[model samples]
Target: MKKKYVRLISRAAVWSPRFGGLAFLILLFSILLQRFSVIDVTVFMILIIISACCVVVSLFFAVKALYSLWVYGALGGMKALRGIIYSLTTAIPLVLFWGFWFTLPALHDVSTDIQRPPTFFRTARPSDALPLKSVLIEQAALQMSQWPEMSGRRYDGSPDRIRESVLNVLAAYDWPVIAQKKFKGEEDELYIETVAKSFYLGFISDIVIRLIDEGDTTFVDMRSASRYLPRDFGANAAFIIDFMEALDTEIALLPLSQDEK
Candidate 1:
């Protein structure tokens, strides 16, 4: 009977290694998560240390459990503690590390940005060749970068307030304003020209706002350019808000039904 009991314990110990191996694999993933760049470096580093300790501690417990069960013919408390320790420690860091690791990078991808501005040779003007005006606008919009503000970092103002503020600025600057027909859909393209110096300026909307100077109007545009607007305003932020506000203003003036909302 004693020999049979010992044989059973030895087999369980052999199988016990499989559990530790699986847990080690999970710990490896957690370690990699801690290395991601978008994760807050401080948080990641702290968790990384914790995770390393967890891996080592879990391994110790696992080995202790096997040794106690198979080598000594008894598990003591190590058998239960082994699964509990390894699972809890591994699970916690794995969830936390990967959560921040994947989320931040996707949220802040520079390519997705549409609020950056393009370089401009000068301020865009109505005069000169139409081809030049079209090309400049197209190129400028293409170069625009995404706005980086997230839900947490967003300003107190809503899109409506922002649009109103922007329009008020445009009116203050004596810049001719036109209300877009709609939100300009996902992509908004425009060709506007103002005659000024020999240099001309063009603007585009994307993650970053790109401005290109095509003619003698090397001067920056104060109305549409971020230089004239708020630095936090993203590529489509100003344009979208202002357009939406203009639509609302037009609707208010029309005396439409309240049910429309």
Candidate 2:
């Protein structure tokens, strides 16, 4: 009986790292597959669950291996140490993956213009709507506290010049504008709609940019809302900031007028 138990522990020790490594691979693949839309969301979700279970089982085996190593010492101890090292190394990525989310808010929708957010023509409605007054207030406060730099920007240029800069930046990034319209009435206003996709999970986020003529300057306001997840971990804000910075860079690169300079 003692020999049988020792053998069983030894076998588990050898397999723990393999199971943990397998779980890590499945998780990595699930993220990649989801990003490319190669697998159904439900299937990917199941993969995550299965991967978690595998990790748990691996952990159990690892503990058993440690116990066996302590009892048998020598060769058994060395084998168990190898399994522990492999399992710990394999679990690092998964640990970081979830650890990153712990810092972000649990809200899906994000907008630079919370006061008068640009309309979402093709995108889905925000998860926190008017009826959810408390939720909206909390989200607003959170964004204000976390990302005050996400607000609108004013460019010192003619409406046409600013519009050109915006279009140039958008095109340079290959954002694939879905709908864009410019109407000249009381004020020259341009509305543009685009989509942003995540690098890992291929998650979609709808973005809107509104440019309105303000006499000698043009005012730009943008809003970005995710299509699926309730929390984006500041991706939407990052997208808006990137576009604004790119637009500024593009505008600066343009030839300057003698009078303006």
Candidate 3:
């Protein structure tokens, strides 16, 4: 009878996919839990880091197994391939996240008027509300340089009309309004506070839009800040830009009065 032979690389290759698959499942579960609010952001972040480490380990073993198979005629090529594929399943999103983390500015708070950002009516927690004055003037300059188009918008309409259009745009985007204040007099500004949730991760961001009455025109300023993370990966800036564009479109679609036309 011939003796059976099994390479150590073959044994490693067989276990690689199992570890890879477990890592993938953990990544998925963490995301789902975070999205559903079952777990807090801290726990979700920790789970993600653990899953990422597992993926890296699984990939390392899978590659070594493939190298052994090619150079020393080891077995389990298919299993090694499966491990590689499984590891990549979780790796792609993590890679994209890290890419954003490195490429974008480290800013959790973004505003059209950095010097006097619109204040939130009520924060989810006291610690979550960081005063804009606390941010350095250099950071404000950096934000302006990076997002030149993020300045306030001046619309050729009354504050009331502009506020209507702004609310309509927010509703269209499904950003739920938590608090609002209507303009009563020349000294009062129209303020709307809302919360936006990320499409995929469901991360919460507090948003505030303020409309100042400037005689025949209205000046609108918006601010967005992440609830948990110190870095938002440019999410707040992107959201403000998108919301401004949508508001612009909504205002454009409004019919002109006979005197205005």
Which one is best on TM-score? Answer: 3
Q: Write the per-residue lDDT of candidate 3 for residues 76-102, one digit (tens) a residue.
A: 899999998999998999888778878
What's the CA error at residue 72 for candidate 3, in Å?
5.8
The local distance difference test score of each candidate is 0.37, 0.73, 0.83
Model 1 TM-score (2 dp): 0.29
Off by over 4 Å in 3: 1-9, 67-74, 126-136, 182-186, 258-261
In model 1, how large is the Cα lDDT of residue 228?
19
Clash totals for all models, in order? 58, 4, 0
Report the poorest 10 consecutive residues by lDDT, candidate 2: 128-137
Candidates in order, TM-scores: namely 0.29, 0.80, 0.87
- Give the worst 10-residue stretch by lDDT in candidate 3: 128-137
lDDT of 2 by residue, 107-127 (tens): 666666776677755544445
RMSD value for candidate 1 = 16.4
lDDT of 3: 0.83
